[model samples]
Target: MTIFDKFDQLAAARQALEENCGDFFNMVVDDIISATEAVVNGRRMILAGSNNYLGLSFDSDCIEAACEATRQAGTGTTGSRMANGTFSGHVALEKELAQFFKRRHAIVFSTGYIANLAMLSTLVGPDEIILLDADCHASIYDGCRLGKAEIIRFRHNDINDLEKRLKRLAKRNTNILVVVEGLYSMLGDRAPLSDIAAVKRKYGAYLLVDEAHSLGVLGENGRGLAEEAGVEDEADFIVGTFSKSLGAIGGFCVSNHQQLDLVRYASRPYVFTASSSPGVIASTRKALSILHTRPELRRRLWDNANMLYQKLQDLGFSLGPEPSPIVAVRQQDKEEALAIWNALVQHGVYVNLVLPPATPDGGALLRCSMSAGHTAEQIEHIGQAFAAAHRTDQAAQTG
Candidate 1:
């Protein structure tokens, strides 16, 4: 058999999707009108799938910072941080991130995925163990695979399951790292950080919380779920991405442990990958400042999220467990989900159409992520679009 034969199943699935839904997966934005609006397929559509939580992408200060940095520092770093890429702006952003997270040290990476790869693959060695949530991000799983450590997965957000696994490994006399996410991306459900932290402490294990989706969306100071749950001290390391809330491109690992500063030397991903562009670093710094100075952004974000979530629930849609920035409507049938996604687009709303096996469960999700930039009227419009889309799908099925 040819090597290409292995991809036959995937190719068949893609063909089916395209035939059914008109290629929604590859739909491109023709133009970005704002943080909450975009032109897709020559149609003005409300953006409800983008993870711009604080909605600083269109902020004048951020845009200006990016332009100024590009003008001054050129377009790209073109080298790894170990070589010629350690710019002044990069150092400054690291210090600011450490200060913002109240950590003693921080390390920046080219992307959030690499940040996980560097930490997870390097921190725990062959004799060590990594106990992670079953529903953790793909990056976390990939990082684990790159490492030599024995990986164990507990049920998602199940404190009892975590404790049981930790207890079984207690007598192994090896280091154990417990990894969890502050906010799960798919279902938008939150981890029981307080409970997980307590179990980690009881098991004498280290804790790592990936706040990729929770930064600037949780805590009074936007320090994420660890801070909101009052377990920051219990968490040994916190990793997050700027692509989400910071409205730029980069990833970081911040901790009280000074050893994190040395990961740059050993991490292959950090050593080999080119550094982020000067403009991205500058815009990220400006966005972080905005996140710190403007608490109202978080409030407005929650207001919009709550409104959309309530509207969907009122319409008898099966939604995620709780309402936050991410509001996902679960659908059991993939064909119906695709029809609804296309109908929503036709109604001038664009959302993420997540199908299995990517979904947390073996179901489809029409995922909507709220932004502070979304007006109340825009949120109402999104809800109406969903309602209309559902009706159209049902009518098609019945007809």
Candidate 2:
């Protein structure tokens, strides 16, 4: 028997998709013009799928910084930080992140997934317990599995469920860690951090907020949902990524707790993985500066999101919980989702087509993420494309 025989079910599913949907897995972007425009399959398309929130990917300053860093520090860091990967840039970036978040310590990781993995896995032990949100990102779930802590899940965004679980655990003397996200990526909904923080405080549990999707998109200075919800002081750790708002590749965890710096010694993911490249660090630093200095970018992003969301809703399409940067259209089924997705692409638009198991509650999603770089005209064009696609789907159904 083949060792890979267990993946036959998945392989068959892929084959069926490709046969029916014209190679959905093999999408290739021929060129990227900007944060909101790209060339795919030899056609220029409006990009509504990329999560480049602040749209600093094409900023002149960030590009210049990345190029200069590549020239000075070479291409990559060849080893893990625990070995030889700790460069001056890495140290400087960590310090800057600590200052930016007003935290006592900050630790950088190769990627956001690794950041969550390192922090979640290393913070708790067998004697402790982890309370997780059911709808958290996969990285959080993996981190929970890597750790020795007993894991428990509460309903997604249900503060009452969380408090009930905390009350039940009140009699136990075990340490507790509560994990949640600042902004849930799939739904583009902000967490009720104030309420969650209260529950954590009542239970005397550590609260960790993963701000991967919310950083640079919330709060007065774009710190995240914790800051927006006025619960930053209550959160034990604020974890985020540079890839989204910062428009680069890296991740960081900041905390008021001085002991957070010690996670480097315990986290296998951080200890074993190679550090982020100097170019990434440089670009990210520049992006961070731009993110702070340019509040107009956030305003534009929200405006674009609101416009498109209103248009889609007016066209009779069901959307995610609220109007944020991310706008997802929940479909009747996988077939309907794929049909609309393909139609949009055919009409010179590109959005994410998320399938079952990957989507929440086994639903299919045509996810659209807005960038600050998107112009008002581009947003209107996208709305038209979506409306047209929906009309096409309706006509096909009736015919």
Candidate 3:
């Protein structure tokens, strides 16, 4: 094929998708009121798709910090972090993150994506390898490519698969860095960290846990999967995002490995990208403080999780392997999923629509990510909306 043929093929397929299932995917929102709800098409919607687990997006402290930062620091950082973008706020935020994770050091990035890119690329190289979970977020995959490492994949959360890959890696005389997500974003299932940690130790490989989804949603202190599994010390790297729990924009990496400071200089993702603005840093710092002190917030978050899990299962909708904040309602295909998604929005609810190949199975998924801010009334309304959409789809098919 010609060099441009791949682009032509992708353009054609995307056009087909637009033609057949455009409305559901290309929705426009009028206003977002809170973490759990928004106004779209002049109608109020229950926002079950947002990653704002702690629902601190609208916190007064964060907003005020952002406003103040806007006044003081202006709109953007303008230069790369290696040059002039590294602000005092960035340094303070990294220190806060390190303290939060109880690690020796931390580095902040412009985004959770860049955090993965920086860590994986800096940690793995020509003489090192990267092993990632099959269901990990796309950033981890990109990080492997950036590192130019020998990329290996294990079955999603399968300890046996991880062991198999690690065993193979041991024979190669190369350094191994195995990466996994705290929670699989699409499916909303967490990794078996304890088992994975054991296997990594057995094979003498380093482990990196991307706590993007679980940062403020798991653990007693919300330190994420490793803390919950009691294997925090075993993980060589812990990556997280401020977008979810901290209710801001930025990414961080914390580690007890004394060499983390080296990545600040060696990793292009950290050095080249503009550092997070003061507003984001300030807001995230405040949010982190609240999250640390407020254990009740975590309880409320899990309460929402349990309610959604139970209600979705009671509705006869197929769920993921286990219950967590993110819930996936299985659908037949993209067309059916789009139809259901459209029906739900028309009935006043919003959720993420997952289809092949973003979804592993050929089926589509109506993904719901709950937040602590979601009210009981809102949750009830969402359940009713799901039932309504489910009924309408069945009726349409029957007709």
Candidate 4:
């Protein structure tokens, strides 16, 4: 058989998805009206799936900054940062990121995924050990694979499991890097950072927290979970994405350790990948400033999140563990999940449809991410849409 034969199982799964839901995986957005509204397949839908948490994507200042930067610089940075890609904006943003996080050093990357790739793969070597949460993002796993490190997974958010694994490797006499996320994307549950940090300290392991989904969404200064938990100093590294709350495209790793600056020279992902464009850098910088100054945005985001979460729970839908920006409605049956997802679109709402293996519990999820841009009325309308979609799905099954 050819190498292509290996994809038969995946092809079958995709075919099944197409037959049931008209290719939800590839569903296109015909037009984007705002951060919280879009026209998809000729239907205007509330954008509950997009991870625009702070809703700065459409902010006038951010947009103007992007436009001005694009006009000043070119459309794209044609080279990697190691080469000719390091612009004034890039350097400024890195410094700002470090200052905002109150860290000694910061390294910017092409994307959030690559930031994880660069940091995780480069920090730990074959002789070293990486003890990560079982539910860490795929980027962390891929980074582990890219490196030759001995990877060990502890149970998701289980401090005891993490401690046990750390104890087992205590005598190895090699550097151990502990990796986790500030806010888990799937279930919206938070890592017990304080507990994890305590365990890390006991084991003498370096801690890396991916704050990709938590930046600008948590903590008093919007620094993420580590800051909220009062353990920011314990986290040796903090990796995050600008695509989420910052409303731009890029990733970064900031740390109090001055040695972090060396990752720029060693990380293949950083050395090979082209740097973020001028517009992205400019918009992200503006967004960061706004996130720092406007705490009301964070409050509004939480308000909307709590409202929608309570409404969904009131509707008797199974949901994630906590009420963060991410409100994942869990479903045991994949077919039922697909039906509900389609019903949602029919009711003029768009949400993310996550299926098995990708999902934390090997179930399906109709995931909704809240944004500060969404109005109270919009949140209510979304709840009504879910209710109507559920009713439609139930009627279909009975008929």
**Candidate 3 local distance difference test against the native:** 0.87
**Model 2 agreement with the true structure over 94-187: per-residue lDDT tens digits:** 9999888888899999999999999989999998899989889999999989989999999999999999999999888889999999989898
List the candidates ranked by lDDT, beginning with the highest: 4, 1, 2, 3
Mark the regions of model 4 whose C-alpha exceeds 4 Å error after superposition: none
Please tell me which model should have the higher lDDT, number 1 or number 4. Answer: 4
What TM-score would every model get versus the actual structure?
0.99, 0.99, 0.96, 0.99
Query: What is the per-residue lDDT of model 3 for residues 1-399, given as tens digits with 9 covering 90 to 100?
Result: 788986997788778778866664467788988777788767888888888898899888878988898789877888778899988888888888888899989988999999998988888888778888988888988888888788989888889888987887789977898899898898889899999999999999999999999998888889999999999989999998988878888898899989889888899898888878778888888999998788887888899988988998999999888899998888766777778888888878889988787886778899998888999888888898898988998898899
How large is the C-alpha RMSD of every model relative to the true structure? 0.7, 0.9, 1.7, 0.8
Better of 2 and 4 by lDDT: 4
For all candidates in order, the CA lDDT equals 0.94, 0.91, 0.87, 0.95
Tens digits of per-residue lDDT, candidate 1, 1-399, equal 999999999999999999998757678889999999999989999999999998898899999999999999999999999999999999999999999999999998999999999999999889999999999999999999998999999999999999999999999978999999999999999999999999899989999999999999999999999999999999999999999988888999999998888888878889999999999999999999888899999999999999999999999999999998999999999999999999999999999999999999899999999999999999999999999998998899899
Tell me, by lDDT, which candidate is best: 4
User: Residue 226 error for model 3, in Å?
Assistant: 0.3
Worst 10 residues of 1 by lDDT: 20-29
Q: Which stretches of candidate 2 lie over 4 Å from their true place?
A: none
Clashing pairs in 1: none
